[model samples]
Target: MDHVDRTEIRPCRAADLPLLDRHLPTPGAPTRHADRFARQEAGTGTYLLAWRDGVPVGHGQVRWDGCAAPGVRAAVGECPEFNGLDVRAELRGQGIGTALIHAAEELTRERGGTALGLGVGHDNPRAAALYRRLGYGPVVAYTDRWSWTDPDGRTHEEADPCTFLVRDLTTPDA
Candidate 1:
């Protein structure tokens, strides 16, 4: 059996927030995982976390609607979106990311989403390739903008060239 199979993927819980923050720290800011967990608790969306031996190693979130890229938001319509996918640096290439993606897909399907979408940073070809391998096709290219607070609570905005990708969730094979 694969080592990744030994890892458990499940919805985020309040108890998991601290460990998530430790393992996936956001450098100069509060852990983004905490915010996602809050969103999960509020019933706005589902945040999935991967654990190995009681340690949080991966994270991803599925949004029922809205996307940063205008093209994707217009094209995918009401599809759920997978975002904020991250695996611990040392644990990459061990199937953690793939497992997180699969969990997100299953969650979207359970939510009655007929399709799922995601955006990949243009600078990150490796992630784009992984999405492609998982059956996601490019829909449009656009720029994404967002802001984050630094450790000192100073906010900064960022813009990145990105490609939006989508995959039909209506079929099991998709």
Candidate 2:
């Protein structure tokens, strides 16, 4: 994929939901953008979107509440968690995902957070390697679990083993 020369990272807004739905639709549960935006409005977290040429290219969620996994919570006490980072399949490897991560880190620092945490599924070595390269270190291993409803109203659960990584924001390259 060609590198995006000028990707803009910003907080998601209600008006952007339509564009997101068209460009980055979450098929199973498509109201995600609205929900995350609502959470942002409530001061819970920020859902960031990466755009190139006015097209949504990537996104991520910075959870002020930290990881839901008990082990991660216990090990990375009070740390903000960066979750659900996704880049358009055709535009990956061009720094879009990295920019989204950097944006999330900046948001954390702006909120007076000293560190940030994220989970990489055990099966996803590529993502883990990216985090390591960006200064995150594995803190603990835990079951990454969550559930979501489909558009048809069927709920699904997931429980995957993963390693939670934390980065010290005291230093940008740490």
Which candidate achieves the best TM-score against the true structure?
2
For residue 28, model 2's alpha carbon misses the true position, in angstroms, by 1.3
Model 1 C-alpha lDDT per residue in residues 1-174, reported as the tens digit of each score: 888988999999888878877777777557577778877878877899889989888888987664746676777675788898988888988989889888888888777777788889999998998998889999888888888888677999989999888888776643
Candidate 2 yields a Cα-based lDDT of 0.89
TM-score of model number 1: 0.93
What TM-score, computed on C-alpha atoms, does each candidate reach? 0.93, 0.94
**Runs in model 1 with CA error above 4 Å?**
none
Collision pairs in model 2: none
lDDT of 1 at 86: 89
Residues 1-174, model 2: lDDT tens digits: 456558989999888999999999997777788888888999889999999999999999999989878888788876999998999998878889888999899989888999999999999888988999999999999998777898788999979999999999998453
RMSD of each: 1.5, 1.8
* Deviation in Å, model 1, residue 151 alpha carbon: 2.7
Candidate 2: worst 10 consecutive residues by lDDT?
Answer: 1-10
